[model samples]
Target: MTNFLPMTKDDMSKRGWDQLDFLFVSGDAYVDHPSFGPAIICRLLEKSGYKVGIIAQPDWRSTNDFKRLGKPKLGILVSAGNLDSMLNKYTAAKKYRSTDNYSPGGQAGLRPERATIVYCNRIREIWKHTPLIIGGIEGSLRRFAHYDYWSDSVRRSILVDSRADLLIYGMGEKQIKEVAAQLSAGISIENIRDIAGTCYRTETLEHLWDYIEIPSYQDVVNSKKDFANAFKFQYLEQDPIRGKTLAQGHGEQFVVQNQPAMPLTTPEMDEIYDLPYQRTYHPSYTAAGGIPAIQEVKFSIVSHRGCYGSCSFCALYAHQGRIIQARSTESILREAQEIVKMPDFKGYIHDVGGPTANFRQPACEHQMDRGTCRGKQCLFPNACKSLDTSHTEYLQLLREIRKIPGVKKVFVRSGLRYDYLMAANDMEFLRELCEHHVSGQLKVAPEHISPKVTKLMGKAGKETYLKFKKAYEKVNKDLGKEQYLVPYFMSSHPGSGLKEAIEMAEFLRDTGYNPEQVQDFIPTPGSLSTCMYYTGINPLTEEKVYVAKTPHDKRLQRALLQYRNPKNYELVREALVKAGRQDLIGYEAKCLIRPPRNKQNIAVSQPENWNKKRRLAPSRTQHSKTKQTRKI
Candidate 1:
């Protein structure tokens, strides 16, 4: 009897409908929260006077479950949940993940490896000629020819691979609306090629205009350089304002991607967030452990979308765009009131931020008009002179959220960029953060302490991190608070070698900080770092970058990052000797590890020609020919 979207045929019958307008198939469980893409898209379609139902995590092995709601009136919308299906199922080490947060009861293997392709294939067995549209982080990021970390090879665009009629690439509120309207107006899915933020396959490029053609899938598979160059073109043309149509060839056909959808205005953002949502997992899931992913966002409110802090390893900018679109304070406050009204409401409002918490507005005025600078970064190589450094509005919004009637402790757990905060040149926000927001420790991502690696990561150098550390200590000192800074670090990135990893270990030694959590870099699709990982060349620079592809090579770097762990002792020693830094193996006070005693001495499994292998590793080189890649 509840107003949840029809997940069952009976629910459709309850709504007095024989067939629905859209039957959305998602890789994740049915969670009616706005943070979930499937929820927003379905709710938006419903708002447009279309009946929408969701078939979450359908048994892809057969067509029976997919037929539960029969075929949709317009088309079947598909998504591999909020996360890519491959990423959701695998870990950085290419091992089975222990659990899937998006699944009911936090189960794994409920969804297939490539859910969109698998689901569509199964549905095709039943509804052979029905329109199939795919979109989500997985579909969007892999909308072009991409390197699949799991498969360890170049794969065709999802639009081509899944044989979907269309692919929505970015945040889909706008694109979905346009697509649904066009479909309702009796436009063939094949003819709906002009919508922004969408991709489609064509037999020829005759219908396309204002487009740049990248190398074909065959071209990339044959040459690494061509792969890097193709990614560069896809990266540069992602902006809605300045971006142009891009087409990549697949066999005899071409997959064309239209310009990105424009960033949603504040009122537009408010409208999407203000939509009626049940704000939790479907009732049937309650008997199980419920959807694990909802717990993170059920109480947390997303204040904005998109991030300008373009760390190379992050895919946010690729999916969300660099231009920030934030909800009005009143809109956010209304969501907070709704949170307070929940039956299980606690005094604590967990987190209030987006991809980057401190970035509530666009970096500068130019982004809204001209789009973000193509080949330049906003915060890397020092914050741009035109960057907006003030945090007044964000700070004020936080103040207002905490003062809400039932809220007791409001936290900002979505980590803020320390570099962005430092660029402000004002301590007011920092002081306020230390005094109020932090829960004894504030986690920041300096990522690495080595200059070479950090530079390649598009991150601030060690100097900036040190300056921020000193200032943070002073702020906490002035406030008489014992708050600490927990910095996040990544190992085995594109530019990192044993030498850079050692530099990080030494920094940890000097700081006397031992991190319990270490993030080893994972090369997922649609990220600059992933491109570098696949090609061993920086797409933005066309420069040869050192990449550790071997499992042993990666282990060495990860071991060096967590050098203090006793389990890493042998691996750390192996890495140090391989790097020709055997002096670090001594019992000196500055040494990474004390020399092993006779009883403790153990041999680590390493290549017979360790020195030769280390010497053979790729090193950085200058190649400026392909300099037109995406920086953010």
Candidate 2:
């Protein structure tokens, strides 16, 4: 029978089972949609001839909630929800956010900080021998010893803190399959250390082969130089084709990560997403307004996974990897047909894309056999000659979805890499994109326009965005459509300073763009930019980079993005004067902000004070595959 995995003891009883083979514990409320990681993992296990039940957002104050399903026959899988717990609970400014989109009714405080550790510790107090496995964004990104921005220190790998028997780094289906099979065959969790994309801790590294050793946890904590070096080593070796096993010492023990699992093939992607997902939050959550995060993705089709954009601030490179694995056109159409039958679907199909919507294949021919050219990016500084910039497959997929019966408008909400589209040999994708796919405004991420800052961000040059903008305008002009392009901008990245901030403000002024969506960089762990933010050195170049560390600098940079706003007038005026661009403070049409009308001082609200006003956790403002925290 197609149903939600057991969430309560009575659910198991109804399923005619006294115990489950695996107990899945997630920090988010259980929403059995394929988009949610916990649901995917549990559903995948169920399809593989194993029994799995989810214990979503359990109360960690006591072990009772953890014990509701009793000890699993084989193991327990832990995840910190779709988004990381800390990032889910707080805003970029490090203030308590009142809403958690993953929680039921958008409630807060259901999960504790560092949820994996707390949950695992609670599980251990009762069932010490049951195998514990941790994965998902929080555990995967923190699989190594890395910097923690909230604590202002380098913490050990999550494996050490959670005491999990194993850590699966990437999207963990392949690793989980192997572990489950081994466990089912009477293999112990202690001996299941050699699987690809899995991490295990040991007192010795003698059993490992073809491995590289990174800086020990102590070295990273003590020396910023070592910290940069350690991050650089791990950054370049993320490819499955060329990546090697990595070992890092933490005190007398070591955390060893095997080579990443191979990217899922088209058939594999089809099956995983096709699993019988209930496609909504549990029925038990109906009264509290259900999960807010599922609203966007419930009717949306995830056409693909992974990205190669290599934006410095994004963790997709670390989590989903660069390889593009997409579902077959038939599979996507099948899902679309299913959505058409849903009770609440309406006629509009919310989205039909994933990561980079336009990306339908690997960046180049060599990626499948030789891996991504080690440190070089396919779309950075300039588009690589070997890069394949075709949108033919994706455009056809969209056309087919539009043809589906009872479907009206289909929008491409996933980010479209404009630089890639601009570099393509065909203009049909851009033309068709503007005419058919756009829903009035197409959102693109042009994080920064400053050459130096863009260079550090691993983004295309300003010329690319400019050229694409003209093309988009021309396309909409020919189609007689008045569509708009909403460009997402970020402030206070590692390489951005007052000079760069003033330049962005000037670009906004000249372009007449008053950004409602602004991303102030939050240095989350497991990203190259976070490494630079901590050590003041770009891991890629090993050269010194300017980091805006102080609250004063962050305020000025963020305020500059919205210079025309009345609330940001003081900060913007002060920034212009600090940059020696006092000419921009006058009443001229080109000036970013006008001189104060009256000398009377006005109190402006800071981020901490402003977050006090309750708000839902906003959608993706940062340049990440995962929807991470942004300014409230």
Candidate 3:
């Protein structure tokens, strides 16, 4: 049931076929989200018959929308807007910073790297020799050679700076429909090195280059800061012809392929969530006034894909494989009744959840024929004596999508694995997920409260986030209201520093809660927390610790988790007086600590140098001399 190749728009003006066997090209904007992983590899290469077309956010104002799909037998897939903008260009250089500090209600800004290297050199100047295939989550978490955090160094290998001919890393729907059915059967880009979550670039040594297996771009150019420990260090099981080999050798003697990374069939996730969504917004972001598409149109729905809470600053259990794979709850209520027949259905659907949305299933049941369960601790971290924690079909699929009918509210807004909801056997499903899917704040991440930095970020401790914040404040004080939990904390992870971010800013000043948004550990790219943020230790427990590893002490331990900013009170008062913690300095530190008063409101809002206040006003010397003479 996988043979697709049907081009439309009157079959490309009845066969003068201006290049399309597949094209896509995105950075996100084709009514983004819930059509993820590059809109399911462009609807699985238009259902396997390839002749696709898409250019979502392209138009570098002439390069004719990357040459209006006109030079394509096969070339171009690209995707940079999910999985944290495909492998970190430090969230696309903090969205090309001219200051908007990571999505302050985003405005489709930040495109730099010279506008993504001039939109990949104008789509290779209108497809010269086609093929560009870069793959999502910021080109598969910056495929090979890491650390760029807005060019702070060690770059190269986003497939040789996006010149891209191949790079289809992680969860690419059957490696982009088997590289668009071997480039629409004509093959040859040196025969796509037998495609399997591809990453090409070679000149020889072919153990199947024409059939595809030429990986070893000089062991990712001599182990570029150990490309995610050389792709999870070796795990081959199938590569006689491409698909599943998950890493091999080069640098620090690599080897993690004990076989297990592949899971995307539920009719390839319901034919990539039945494509063609016009959830809308992106006529160059509604003509640059941006930041509105009904506030980034996210009626999203996924439910599950993979993650069994490995969390060493996660890469979703190494790119989707801690095994979960959900979808059918009548395919998430027919994609939440087609996002309430979208004309921007804003009765709030926004997010249902995935990756950790109360983990829908597959922690084991020989995970659909013996694929994952080689278990290594994760049954609510110490409760897995054959764990079940009964989510009861994810709380009966969020109570049948809050009984459908123009659903007005149903957000789990992702990130909720609170030790699998404090190993739920029913706190009445967290009081029916806080009386019908909270929107009046519920977030939860508990990223660190310092049980030795949540066991070096794999997590579970600080009494399991103070027992899920006293069972979400005793189910919001017996549903008497005033619901709140937002939590989420992380600062310089890699065995945290400044005494575990001042013991997590004194456990958020003794749990009154301070987080006015904090997250500073950005080591991204196939995480194990960016190999303990570039080898401060713990590449699988080689331990060692104390690493705020600079970036001005990881921005003063992420401004001590928003100690109510006065530009983070003189860098958390010189990191709490160089960690002797001068009793958390100045304001009796009970927590939401905002004192240095934005450096006394930037020295009382500047602008007062009218000739240095008329040369320190009063020419004092003359006045003093006159007074002295009078006294004499």
- In model 1, what is the error at residue 571, expressed in angstroms? 0.5
RMSD of each: 7.4, 5.8, 25.8
TM-score for candidate 2, please give it: 0.94
Runs in model 2 deviating more than 4 A are 597-632
For model 3, residues 1-632, the per-residue Cα lDDT tens digits are 11222223444666545557777766555443444455556655655666676665565756876665566666766665553443323341254333221222353354434334456667887766777777665666565555555445545557666676677667777777776777768786656665545666554333432232223435444543344344434211221122344433223222112123267666656656666544444333445544332343357687778777777776655456666777777877888898888785876786776757788877756556645433255553565655566788888888898899989778776777777677764788888888888756676677787777777676788786678778877997899866666666777877788888888877665664655556677766556666566655554445656666656888888888765557777788888888877765533334333234464455323334533432221211222221110000
- Model 2 lDDT, full chain set: 0.87
User: lDDT tens digits, residues 247-337, model 1?
Assistant: 8899999998999999999999999999999999999998888998887788999999999888899888878999999999999999999
Q: Look at candidate 1 and tell me the lDDT of residue 423.
A: 92
- Residue ranges of candidate 3 with Cα displaced over 4 Å: 1-46, 50-167, 170-178, 188-190, 193-198, 201-272, 276-335, 339-408, 415-441, 444-481, 489-492, 495-498, 512-525, 537-632
lDDT by residue (tens digit), candidate 2, 1-632 = 23888988889998899999999999999998888898888888999999999999999999999999988999999999888888878777889999988888999999999999999999999889899999999999999998888888899999999999999999998899999999999999999987888999999999987889999999999999999999998999998999989999999999999889999999999999899988999988899999898878888999989899998998888889999988999999999999999999888888888888888888988899998889889987788999999889988998999999999988888888998888895698888888888877778888999998999999987788888888888889999987776788899999999999999988876776677658889888899999999999998788999999888899999999987568888898888888899988654555676466554665333345333332322322222343322321
lDDT of 1 at 490: 90
Q: TM-score of each candidate? A: 0.94, 0.94, 0.31
* Model 1 alpha-carbon miss at residue 345, Å: 1.5
